[model samples]
Target: MKILANDGLDQSGIDALTAQDFEVITQKVDQKDLPEFINTHQIKIILVRSATTVRKELIDVCPSIEIIGRGGVGMDNIDVEYAREKGIHVINTPSASSESVAELVFAHLFSGARFLQDSNRKMPLKGNTEFASLKKAYTAGIELRGKTIGIVGMGRIGQEVARIALGLGMRVVAADNNVGKASIKVKFYNNQYINVDIETEPLAEVLQESDFITLHVPAQKNGFMIGEDEFALMKTGVAIVNCSRGGVIDEKALLQALDSGKVRFAGLDVFINEPTPDNQILNHPKISLTPHTGAATLEAQDRIGLSLAEQIMNLLKNK
Candidate 1:
């Protein structure tokens, strides 16, 4: 059997599949040429990350494909139901990258809280010349120790964030469409751990009370989850981070909020128009940007690859 990892797979994953006599191909096949390549190679399985799209059109042409796998959590890029309806197996690695993504969330949160994002940029340009003036400008940094962190989605990633927040002595409040409450297990380096019960609150309530907000929701198929009205519900001078899907928070509304001083700062890992994000958001001084690297860690990539390999092997064995 042959698997086309269109967006590339980790070596561990490739090795695992190859050990089972499966040929794993990591060539960068253009979207327009995928059908031809799959047909030519007779690919039995297809694996993809965010860079590739597995819509109904491609699915219709790739009749030899037995399984369509997403390397990360969300299946928004794939036509999941349509593929399953065609008697094809659709799988995703939901738990694999949770810890890695959760850590990046804090990377943004900490940078925002301590003025590290702004200072890093400014200090290199004016550190020696305007040392005293630079120090005066960044003195209003906030602390995350006692601040409240609102998690917009209480899935695996959200729970990880909650665990980290609790460990840092910060209050964790979360809101999810499905989950009412969750038990977050905080692990210490000394092998001590504690279970903290967190009840999911209403979105408005979470928005109103939280000092910092981080999103972990699935892609919104219909429209923006956090729009103007949602922004209105948040506290004044709130710090927001979106490592989830792009357009989850209205970009226009976010800019307005940032300009008006309603939102103190924003950390954005995803964007509405990826690869070519809006210049207004990118150029904004108050926003910290990363090009959708939430699950780009080495550990996460390895975990995703191994998880996909395991699931594929198990499913193929059953077949």
Candidate 2:
């Protein structure tokens, strides 16, 4: 059983895999060189992260590969449908990273609502002025308690968000295109919303009604599901959070909305471009950005690694 672990792993994890008697080849392959490395190894299982894209080129190179294991939830890095067509299995450790990502959503919520990043930045510039300057600015913040939150996708991560939101005393409304009339157990809202209805009622209704809106849909190339038309519908001073896949929300549209005050603050854990340079979102005073680390916590990483390891081992043994 030969495996290629391209995603970085802790020493403990590597030792555990060694104990499993699998010959694991560890290498650092950037996106450009991933296909060649896979081709050279003739690996049966390849582990990867969002940094390495497992597109058709990589898939085509690995004739012996049986499974492509994504170390985290989002398989956005892999061409899942194409892999399926090629008789290759794609597995992701979705549940493994749920809590970590959900917590990151809240971290963004806190930073976006409270302007933590900017305040931290401005602190060093102030020499004589009291820290009270930043304290006064905090007055614009609103408590998460007693706020209405609308979640666009209510999958595992979204459901976890709803759990935390309810704990914080925020009301929750969810809409997913696939799930129709399904009921969730969170006590924040009495009514369940469907995607069709959510789109019809002028998105602004949800924006106006919700103090915070967090998106958790998968990425699509059609320029995200949210755009100028949807942004125009948001209430002034609305806060937006995106921790799902990149490209699910239009970056430029978000910038314009932030500038116009249609979106008061945006907490973005993912972006249209991975490792996005010091762009407007990073420089924007009202936006909080992370380097796509929503599911990068130690616990999440270990869970995902172990999950992927098990799945790969299963595939090799069963096949």
Candidate 3:
């Protein structure tokens, strides 16, 4: 079987598939020509990250495709329901990138709390000229220990963040529609580990109680998960982080909260628009921003690729 990895697949995944006698093509095909290319190559499976869009039009034209594999979580780029309706298997490595994303959430949280984002920017520009002045500017910073972090989604990624927070001595509370409770185990450098049970609470309670809030929910079909009213429920000066899907948080509301001092700081890895995010959020001094790189780490890419390759092989090898 032939597979087309349009948005590029990791070399590990390609090697794995090739080892099993599956022809894996890692080429950039123009979106307009994808249908023809798939038809010409008779590709049975297609793998994508976030760049490519597999919609009903593409699926309708490429009838030979048996599977659509997303290297990471979030199938918003793919027409998952339509693909399934056409008898194509849709798969994603939801668990593989959880640790990477969870780590990024902290990367933002830590940097934001200590004012690293601002200092890193200003220090380079005027470090020698205004060393002590910059220090005074960043002296008032928050510490993570003993602070409460509210996780909006208690899925794999959210749970991993909770474990990390607990290890750092931060109190963790989570709210999830599906998950009622989770057991998190934190391991120390000395090989000692502690297991803690946490129950999901009401969104309002978590919002009102947390010192910092991080979002890890899936995309909403109707609208944003958190908007003006939700922000109003949060404690004043609460820091916010989002590594989940874009559009989950209302950017407008976030900006307003930041301006009104309802939100002290924010770390955003995902945006409503990719490659061309809103300039308001990008230019905000109080927001520590990354370009949707939650799953860009090398380790996560390898795991995602290997997992995707294995799943694809298992499903297609039988046919």
Per-model TM values vs. the true structure: 0.98, 0.88, 0.97
Steric clash pairs (candidate 1): none
Instruction: For residues 214-284, write the lDDT of model 2, one tens digit per residue.
Output: 98878786656888888776677888899888887888898888888888888988877677644776788
Candidate 1 stretches with Cα past 4 Å from truth are none
Where does model 2 exceed 4 Å of error?
Answer: 10-16, 127-130, 181-205
lDDT of 3 by residue, 1-319 (tens): 8999988888898899899998988889989999999999999999999989999999999999999999998898899999999999999999999999999999999999999888888999999999999999999899999999999999899999999999899999999989999999898888999999999999999999999999998888999889999999988899999999889999999999999999999999989987799999998888999998999999999999899989987886686
Writing each residue's lDDT as its tens digit, candidate 1 over 34-130 gives 9999999999999999999999999999899999999999888999999999999999999999998899998988887777888889999999999
lDDT of 2: 0.77
How close to the true structure is residue 230 of candidate 2, measured as C-alpha lDDT? Answer: 81
> For model 1, how big is the CA root-mean-square deviation?
1.0
lDDT of each: 0.93, 0.77, 0.93
